[model samples]
Target chain A: MIAAVGLVLGIVAGLIYEPTVPTWLQPYLPIAVVAALDAVFGGMRALLDGIFDDKVFVVSFVANVVVAALVVYLGDQLGVGAQLSTGVVVVLGIRIFSNAAAIRRHLFSA
Target chain B: MSRLALGRLAAAARPRATRGQLVAAVLCAALGFGLAVQVRSNQVAGLSTLSQSDLVRILDDVSQRTARLQAEARDLEDTRAAVTGGASGSRAALQEARARTRTLGILAGTVPATGPGIEFTITDPKNHVHADVLLDALEELRDAGAEAVEISSVGGEQVRVVVSTHLVDAAGGIQVDGTLLHSPYHFLVIGDPRTLAAALDIPGGVLDVLHQEGATGMVAQQDSLTITSLRPAPRPQYARPAPASGR
Candidate 1:
């Protein structure tokens, strides 16, 4: 319940404030958001499994965003930024799908 | 079964796992914020939603369009310059041809002339004046730059004097180009009046020599005179225009 409240509050604040993302971060913000979504799904699956850890969840969230941005930055320097960014999204998307399936099974028990 | 389910639900709802729950709440908040911000920015900057390859394709299309339009504009400018230049060039040539025609028409004596000149009246009561004496007077006025000349008798018989005009001493009259006339003769001349009058009054000139023939010549300077006599322009049968040479 508290997490749901926090999520709603954050969305409302983001919509109202319209924070300006810096130019250097423009390319990475969407990727970072995708990685964060993957982390949330994984946390939900862990919670359903009765094995959610506070430290692990927080670390994974931060690490997922940072690693994704760094890979994209390296790809830009290597002149294959578009292809590499696609690879990152694909991997995070797979993870989010599997975790979501697991959460659905826990909730519906089917 | 209901009691066991109630006990398990109460345990799960207890605050024992509060630390992890708090962390989960914070992470969820961050996730939601990033999602909302990304969505908003995507709406604000429409191009940000496109992929890198898509943006490159768009840029290529725009640049190619711009280059083609520039070339088209240059072509139009060149055509406009050529059209205006040709129009002006032809206009000047037309004006020059018109002016040349006017000058040629005047010089060919196909048109009447008007200017200041002198009228000479010779009194020949006994008809002692011959064709040679009249010719000398005509020649003298011509030498004084006479532009146009005509001779008329006291009876109003007149002839336009041109380069081909011939004077003959006919019986009882002077026949000028087959037109016979008796004295007193009036020569209507068109030129500088002062010059023509002086040319006639010189010692031993037409006026002085007329006295020996028992004829008296009177000169009157006039401010303006109109010579209405005109001659037909001759067309040459044998003469042809020469071909242009580079030199």
Candidate 2:
């Protein structure tokens, strides 16, 4: 319950502040968001399974975003940025879909 | 065995969510908040412009200005060449002035011009074609060194297209300079045929956009393309050339 309140507070703070992202980090923003989404869905699925681990969730969330951004940065250096970004998005998208599906089944039993 | 039953069995055997569950839920919410903010910012940054037509008009204005600058540069180059040609006599001067006049006249669309170039026929069945699309094609042609361009409906009278021409929406199609152009808009451009054709065929170019929007754009290169249409000389009411100091 405290966590839920913290979550709501974080969302409110984010909306209120509406901070600007730096221009240098602009290219990685979308990829990081997708990675974060994948992590969120995974956490939700774990929670439904009654095996939620805070350490694991935090680690996965940070790692996912960092690795996704790193891959894109490397791709930019190699002159294949667009192709690599597509690859990352596709992988994260599939993960998010599966996790969301599992969460749905756990919640609705359908 | 049903998958749901097996999932239930596995879920029931696992320990109940601990205090860590709260942390994970909070993180998830934070992630959601971040995603929302990111999406909103992206939208605001990308589309602060008013509407599609406004964007197109801005692009058209920029391209027309670029074309005008390029024409001016070409004129300067011709004049420089004439000055450096070492023709000192009055006859040479007269010839140079006449040549410059012809070149400027052609560029200003006040004189007819014919040469090798490419022609385009765009057939829009849905009449949803935008004037900016045609203007983009003209810009591409100009960038590829097109000297003259004339556009008309396939069966209608052609008009000389100038940098200052405005394309307005009509009942059935578009109206360029008071002439209602129907579908299958024909464009005759005089330039390097290879360069002009390549410009249209470039990947993700004008042709690709037209194709994506359900418009059929076709280009054909010709050894000789004639542009017979002419624009009348502008009679400036308030602006005149500055008088020469010695005169």
Candidate 3:
């Protein structure tokens, strides 16, 4: 219960968080949020299925945050935050699909 | 019957552990709390360092603001061009004022600009008197050594800064191509910040009037400031005539 409550609080903090960014680089928030959610749901389902080890969960979480932030960083470098965010979202979407399918098959016998 | 009993005994011997579940739950909760603290600290830090960007961004925003100001100055040249080319009338004057007003909206935010400059930000009009008194304040910043100024609505709404000299719509919106601006004006000046401060303090200046009128405005000086670049927007063009119209 405490863990759930802490998770809730962390999520709220994330929602309210807005890092100082240039005016031209404002569209990455949505992509980051969606990618984060994809990771959480996919990880949670994998954990329930007993197939997602602690190593995989930790690795995925780090990659999600780092990759999302890296895209923004690269976009800022390339003078194209919007474009980088779009690319990041595309990659995350693909991962989500593939991961969800694997988890589904693992969790449920067809 | 002997085999089934033996399997049941084996299952009982290796029942799942509650200790592991409890440990995982506690660890997860600790991680969550730690993340929350980090996020809150970051938020506070982010606010304090407003417009904070990486080095590349810092340079980009400065250049962008400079380009935007240069673009407006070009608009002024266009006005001069039109006038010198013998374009004159109430229509031209109205068009020029409209263009300046739109530029004013965009200029409301202080772009990180360097090279001896002052910045003044005027909060929104709380009353009719305050609203009526803003033009004088704008003049003060200009006389104080401000080369360019922008007056924008709160948060630089679309109505606050349009890119063109086009007439403001009835909604007090400046249209820049398709962008609009609305208020909470920021006036940026690109000259000696201290000299500009003195200019505003000159006897019988608008600052004195505003002090008497009880309006709110703030002026600040910076050794180094950078304004972020506005993302490039699509250029507007005249619509092509249909075949029927051409005929």
Candidate 4:
């Protein structure tokens, strides 16, 4: 419940502020978002499984965003930014889907 | 995946608002903020999803369309020029045809002609000047580049002389083109005056023959004279323009 409130509050704050992202960071923002989504799903699954840890959850979320953005940045340097971003999105998407499936089964008993 | 042993032990007796939930809330907050920002940026740019190859293909298509449109414009311009210039082209053709008509009228002796030329007067008191002698004089004038000629009897009749004019002796005079001509017969000719006078004064020329016949011939140069004699345009009876030859 608190996590959902925080997510809503952050979205409202982002909408109100309408912050200007710098040009160099714009390319990796979407990839970071997808990675963060994957991390959230994973955290949700762990919580339902009764194995969630504060340090592990926080570290994984931060590490997911950082690593995803870093790989895209390196790809840009290597002149393969488009291909690398695609790869990152695909992997993150699969993880998010599987975690969401696990969470769905736990909550619905279906 | 193996459970985090210390985390599993800590969460064995789960509590509300645990530290893990607090951290999860912050991470979720960050995730939500990122999602909002990426969504806003996507709406603003709207082109980041397109690959470089796709953009290049679109550019190539637009360039080809522009080249085709330019060529079509040039073709339309040429067609307009040809259509609008039609009147001027016809006008030029009409002017050339009129000029040709005037030239033909002069050559056919159906129009009065004027230029520098000589006047030849023969006083034949005894009617010693015959048709053949007059004919010889006309031939000499033509050889000397006389462009127009008319034979006129003083205060009598004027007859325009052409290439096919007929001459014959008659009662005490000469009949030219069925018109009786008595002395003094005046010949008004259009040509180079100096050349015509030189041709007449050559040894064994017209003046010499007239001198031997006891008839006197006089030649005078004039700067400008108009032969007012105009011939009736001839209607060809047996001859017509050939099929393929320029006039």
Q: Against the hidden reference, what TM-scores do the models get?
A: 0.60, 0.43, 0.29, 0.54
Best first by DockQ, ranked: 1, 4, 2, 3
Q: Arrange candidates by lDDT, highest first: which order?
A: 4, 1, 2, 3
Best candidate, TM-score-wise? 1
Candidate 4: deviation at residue B120, Å? Answer: 1.1
The global C-alpha lDDT for each of the candidates, from Candidate 1 onward, is 0.84, 0.82, 0.54, 0.86
Error of 2 at A109 (Å): 99
iRMSD of prediction 1: 3.6
Candidate 2 stretches with Cα past 4 Å from truth are: A1-110, B1-88, B243-247
Q: Write the per-residue lDDT of candidate 1 for residues B1-247, one digit (tens) a residue.
A: 2443334434444555487678777778877887898899888988866657669989999999999999999999999999999999999999999888765644565677777899899999878999999999999999998878889897678787887788999998789988898899999998899999999999999988889888899999999988776667879899987888874
Clash-forming residue pairs, model 1: none
Question: What DockQ does candidate 1 score?
Answer: 0.37
TM-score of chain B of 1: 0.67
- Give candidate 2's whole-model lDDT: 0.82
Model 3 scores a TM of: 0.29
Error of 1 at B240 (Å): 1.7
Query: Across all candidates, what is each one's fraction of true contacts kept?
Result: 0.55, 0.34, 0.11, 0.53
Tens digit of per-residue lDDT, candidate 3, span B29-137: 4345435444554565543322334445777888999999999999999999888766567678889998876554345432322355666665535432343355466
